[model samples]
Target: MNGGAVLLPYRSNRPWLSGRDRKRIAQVLVLVLLVLVAAAVPQGPAWAGANLIANPGLERVDVGGFPVCWEKSGWGDQSFTFGLTGPGHTGANAMQITLATSPNGDRKAMMLENPSCAPNVTPGHQYDLSVWYTTTTANTVMTMFRHDVAQGWVYWTDLATLAVTPAWTQKTVRTPQVPADTDQIAWGVTIYGVGTLKTDDYAMEDVTAPATGTACSAGDACVKGVWQVLPFNSPVRGLHTVVLKNGNVLLVAGSGNDPDAFAAGTFTTAVYQPTTGTFINVPTPADLFCAGHVQLPDGRVLIMGGNKAYPAADGSHGYEGLKDSYVFDPATNSYSRVNDMTAGSWYPSATVLGNGDVISLGGLGEDSSGTVATQYFSQAQQRWLGLGEAHQTWNFWGLYPSMILMQDGRLFYTGSHVFGNGLPGTGSSIYDYDANTITPVSGLQNKDQRDQSMSVLLPPAQDQKVITMGGGNIDSNPDANRLTDVIDLKQANPTYTAGPLLPTGTLTGGIPQTTHQGKMYVSAVLLPDGKVFETGGGLHNRADPVYEASMYDPATNTFTAGMAVDPVPRTYHSSAFLLPDGRVMAVGDNPGNGSFDMRLSVYSPPYLFKGARPQILGLSSAEWAYGSTRVVTVDGPILKAELIRPEAVTHSSDPNQRFVDLPMSVSGNTIGLNLTSNPNIAPPGWYMLFVVGTNGVPSVAQWVHVG
Candidate 1:
């Protein structure tokens, strides 16, 4: 609100006013008060805007269970109630929207909207939307949308992110110039996180402010970073995406997004060109919804396991694990069937071992008890090597457990997963792939976080830290947990302690009065600069409510807002990874009632917005040994050099994507970089080589194999 809060006088004896009288007086008083107090209104335009809402108060209840003159849609989850009995911010009645149980592991179940009757507005006018609200639980966000007849109701902006506070505070949402192509303007509000929120008075009108100042124009905001959406569309929804060694993107979504294609196991694949906005069709052998993927030492991608079929009668899928596997040959942009696993697997986690084989673990198996049997694909023999059965008691690591190979050749579990269909496997664990045994890791404060929580092998893999962020319960009334914890797996007693708070995104054009949205399903891609670009996640109530990407800085242990915003809403089953050119490709947005987004978006980081991107002039070899120093040349001043393990992501968790900082000494355009012999840090496979400049810019990646 431009003016200070007005404490409406309490008349005690004669406090009850007719609904009509109450709205009229409130509008008049507020307009007069704003004109007197707002000294910053722009000078060019005369203040002539009026309250466009039909009713500002909730005193008049309609037969349709909404306030008079207002219309609403969605599940029966809203009400206009009166006074202390109602939980309003003022007088007799206030509007309340409730969060209901969700329909699936990755679907939004609530949609309570209240819209104005298409208010008339002027062209080139700016407006402010204000409301007084308080909530019972944290991170309950209010959203607004603009109804474009052609595009339907598109998200216009977010107003505020409220926490669990008792006081009624006023929040404002200021929108840019109103579109001149629209016939009328309408706004609506809804709650995304958990809990209920009460609202009383509301207002929407034009205000004035000075436009002159030290303003930021084009080329200014790119000093740090920026995001620009490309002009082309990805042919297939990027349910599964990987950056190929050839600087192209390999996208996989087996199942042409037919309503029943996922259950029936459809195969649809393509290769996306980052340089040109075009897609080349590639075919897959089977649907890879719950499959595991890893880049091979020979620069191929091993795609293991996926959906077989789930009978439609049961309503909820039992996740029929598949015994089939395939290897994607980037050389031909095609897939080849490989040896099947010892047992059928769905949603398995795969990681490349020190010797070039892949250790595959967890996920629903043929018998569906978390598949006690484990297996590894021998790249040397082109056959499946059975590892016997894994930890029997801890088989419920759920799907895609945070399994990564350690420096000691042991597998460490971060106790996070894509699904929590059963009792969650709590705490971190160390598994000896040889002994087929498990040892509980101590000091982890956040256990039972197996439901879509994200765990990553932190930057400069040598650090040996696994950071896990945001997850929630599988139970009906689920809410996302904003817990960011890190554990030093190298420690004698590796335990997860608190790390930096996960970065929070603001509601579009809104204030920071509340924490916006939950943190489940946040996807991270390790950039060449050693920072993690994270975005897309579920809300507290299972809704995917975020579009703004954030970059995680390891040096300062904080996050800076992504310079660009992606328009797509990528929720559960979505994937993001850094392209060889330093751009980010985001895909997959599964909303569970059989809705899958086949559309994908790419994010050109701020570096792309600057001058011509730096170039990796040359490298001695594409392959390097465990411990060796190599000479590389760049076209620009080299600030740092890093090796990022190429990642294959599914269900928001990528077993790869670790950052290994190369010890570097620069000499003009030439640089010498050192590689560590520790397989636990660098692993044995191909990585994306990047050279960062002092200007915070990065060179396009080149393929570098570490063994």
Candidate 2:
């Protein structure tokens, strides 16, 4: 001992070892205890975080130098290198990016983006970013670029500069609270001069914190999900509406009653995302004005026909027809130009076929009536083919007519249609897709009663009943037809029989009028609740635009006034559709040509505020085949199931919207349903699948593909 202190021995009763030995033994015991404690405690994602980016190792390259599921900047300011020297963080290969100053005098920037693939990094989320990098210089600015759902691009505020070391180093940058709307995830690396940056094993992981919100109450109603007038109004009128499987509404107005918009080549396509309450402006490859669209089997939209821009002087004879077709792929969020159709079709109508093809017909062709030829878009060939002209017996294809695929692989044209003449040629018939033959529908008492009327296939579609409701001819002329017709195709012999008439809309019209007859140009939509919603229609085309709305209950075979009367007039070009959120969206009401107005109105059904709403929490598949059995998980009671065809509305024509009741049996919290094998019952394409609770409240829809 240096000073007065003496070396003290460890006071241990055991004499198995010397003082030094006892001390060493105690040290070993402490180490062992730490290891056991660590092993016993559960290690979750927060502890051993994994990379969220696909192909993170950069080991899998698809022909190009870039990795799969990654979008790279190809603007020459960015260059990528593969197969780096030595071992990468995870594999033999590593990716490198070098930036040189661009001619614009800015540092080169590159972003590796995976869009919409990543869930929103909402506010309650905390993320830690880890990456291995070897750069030629230090202080290279790296940034996290987030594509916000509402706002376009938002940065992390501060640039996370990588502190370069002499050798490769693993570095971690903890991000601040992730914004609520952060949707598309991207990482950007910016460099100055001729600097090279090698990157490997980049990871961004979510670290959850303690719950900070209210607990689920025993009785919270479903109307919490109510009608939200999307934060931004659509730039273009939603004349043609298609509900995308991803829950976004694809609104294509084309020219929007502006004939000059066609010649100007105005890009009138836009998409509204419900999640972020924002609108994304998408460029259109062609004018989709007055085009016919349907969701194809592969989840792509087959949009055929467009405005050739030939407005006639009389307004009744404008016949600018287009034959070109286009396909919008939701996967890429881009449109693909497809070949033209066999013949020109204007104000055309389309319906899905059992064979996964779409048969398009009827438009004011050069003849100013239904187009002569019946054209079908072949999914296999990805082009339109002629099924020859309409059967000589079939004439006067109205503007925006009603065509439905029947249970027997035949396509039925409900003699009822929106425009043109109101009888025979406008009459009902069945056409066989296999034989390419036409079979006329029979037992019709009032042949001309269907002009401008709407027809819908009753729910649980197995019944195969078609209901044709009120409309007028001439000037939407003669007064709206009060008599509603019901034709059951499955009945040994189908005929139009008096079912029920729409309640006098004028009863609720602010102006007291003597006539109780409904107006012409009514738009009908099949609700998830198995009821039919009828909106819009003027007493005489606009002399009396009925603002009141009515709902037809199939169970009661009666029409009852809706809880809320629409403030916006939906007379002529007026369109309404069932939104994925269970509310009804009524848009576009240009009572006449060039008078198109873009006042969008959303109506929340009585079911919304009725009681606690139901929720279709989880869907097993984004895509499923017809007759396929699916297990659906719900958060509430489901007494009935429905699959509504995604809609595309214009005039009185909605190419989509075939409401078919899905065969479902609820066992516990799971719903077991069989997708109808019959394509007519449900066509091959994306549909808004909903489950109705015992209280008549419907679950917010989950899009299901039934091909």
Candidate 3:
């Protein structure tokens, strides 16, 4: 048996009569060989196995190192199917199976029954079952059970408790002959909720159950428990604001839990000394409520209004969102009163405009629900003036209101209906007053209203990108709980372009982050690096868990994180910075597990250093797409261009979307790449491009639109 050649079984033996048979066999063999040889020869660039199983479609085939599958959907009914079935008899009692879904928005699933099998199983027998599945929802489950002519079907009681990994979790269900149904058994996986999901290539082998004494000992072995990296070891609560400052972190707690009946003592705030990892006393105003902090360009931090917390015994004490604002001078390590709002308010948004004035938007006011009041600080006057209320007149609670400053200098607010949920009525947009005339971003209304939704200007670059992260729905449908989605605002609003779609897995709660310093600091910061850093945010349940922080390198259009994770898991946390020395800080609201001790954490560069400009590399169509060319060059100290596709000149379909992946082999200053070609060889489109670094961090994707 030659390793180079795979041999198939053949039958033959005679000589004279075999001579004639041999000739015929030779002809057939030559014909088959010629056909295969012809197929191997390519007219264009070779397909270097670029296709992967993007979705579980009907065409389940793997060739030349690539697994290809596709999906199709009708107007209403949808399914995941294929055209291949294998003939088998040698294996033990076998069942051929695959996964399927009912339709979109419908969470129910049905197993396509095998024509011959009655979904039966016998006790004292062993069976191997396998299923190929993918889902957009979590409540779906694989149900296995038994059936008898006399006693109906005895379903396995712990079917739903089996496993819970969102990805394809393969489980082998071994039966444990209950008192009921010793002879006949029926087993199947079923969907449990109201959303549509699908499975394919379902099959079973050696299907049977344990003889008599075997029953599942462990009932529910699902994934639980928080992955703890460090312990806070302190009992603190009502920690609303967290900040990293002056080689230390500060935890400004809203008065919540205490030992005193009327109140233990004075309102206290703790400062963390990273050098010792301990919280120390910090002099803050007594009864300080919830406050937001912003670092001045010169390094002072401005701390703004929050409500005072009273003892639990006192009925009138809780988060009292206030409008009084103060300034914290890190240099002096002290706090000072700056300016009071024109109106009584708390929970109002205080975002530092590009011009350095803090813009305070809607929050709960003394009058009622929340003030639609919008105010921007006049640096020259050193006072907060009423910019104007929202387009619609109503107080907002700002559960998750939109307070985004667009590239065109517009401030858009949405989701602040009550200080809790962003309803359609609560969703409103406001252009910056700087624009003289305020214009509403019409048509792109908040139909599927959102709360906790995030909006970030895809900072202006050579390519434009604006992105909005995860948000909760105002309406009742849970299916609207989308974990990840992308909007290319660049096409409609040329100035806005969001980052590329995250690779493979869903964004952990739609986290849109930028980089700062050598370390990927989240929350917010203008660390050692010139770029901005956004840590993590909480997302929908189905989305991949985001526990990591990434550095956004705008120069190169990429983000990278080697191994260090965030100091703590923070979703609804406040991340900002104090410049000059460039220390980044974060304070989380409902930090994971509601642990009040999940206090403010700050991050400085693991090592001190000057920053380097991002290395941008452009991919060339000739070198990477489908052409035989394979060369890449770093153009400016910032830009890199390479020929990634060259074979699609003739098949000019959408010449702008084609691209080829290359194997990077560094030779010297010049990096050598094996520019593999595609086989289907459609006309070249723009090549989607990215670059990896010595740190193994790859840049964001860019496209060299093919002509």
The 0-to-1 C-alpha lDDT of every candidate, in the order given, reads 0.65, 0.64, 0.37
Residue by residue across 484-521, what tens digits does model 2's lDDT show?
77787875556667777676655334774345476666
Query: Which 10 consecutive positions of candidate 1 have the poorest summed lDDT?
Result: 105-114
lDDT of 2: 0.64
Residue pairs clashing in model 2 are 221-612, 222-613, 415-427, 415-428, 460-661, 627-675
Cα error of candidate 2 at position 489, Å: 0.9
Q: After superposing candidate 2 on the true structure, give the runs of residues whose Cα lies further than 4 Å from its correct spot.
A: 1-232, 312-317, 366-370, 386-396, 423-426, 443-446, 507-509, 513-516
Over the full model, what C-alpha lDDT does candidate 1 score relative to the true structure? Answer: 0.65
Q: Write the residue-wise lDDT of candidate 3 on 1-707 in tens digits.
A: 11111211122223544677666655554455344423322222212222111212222222211112111212234343322332212211112223355444222222222111223343333333444554454445544444544656444322221223334444433222222234433344444333334355444443221223322222221111012233454333324333332444445554533334116554566655645657666676644444444443333455555554332445544344556777655456567887776554555555545454656655555443455655556554556665452232334435324454443445554222222345344134454555434333333224253344444333222122334333444234232222222233224432222343222112345354332101111132322222334444334312223455444444344554432345454543333332222234444434334333345454444322222223444334432333233434542221122222211000001011112233232222343333322222212233334443322223433434322
> Going through the candidates in order, what is the number of backbone clashes in each?
12, 6, 76
Which candidate, 2 or 3, has the higher TM-score? Answer: 2
lDDT of 1 by residue, 589-667 (tens): 7775656666666776666655556788889888887656577988865556789877788777787779886755345
By how many angstroms RMSD does model 2 differ from the true structure?
Answer: 21.5
Candidate 3: C-alpha RMSD to true structure equals: 22.8
- Candidate that scores best on TM-score: 1
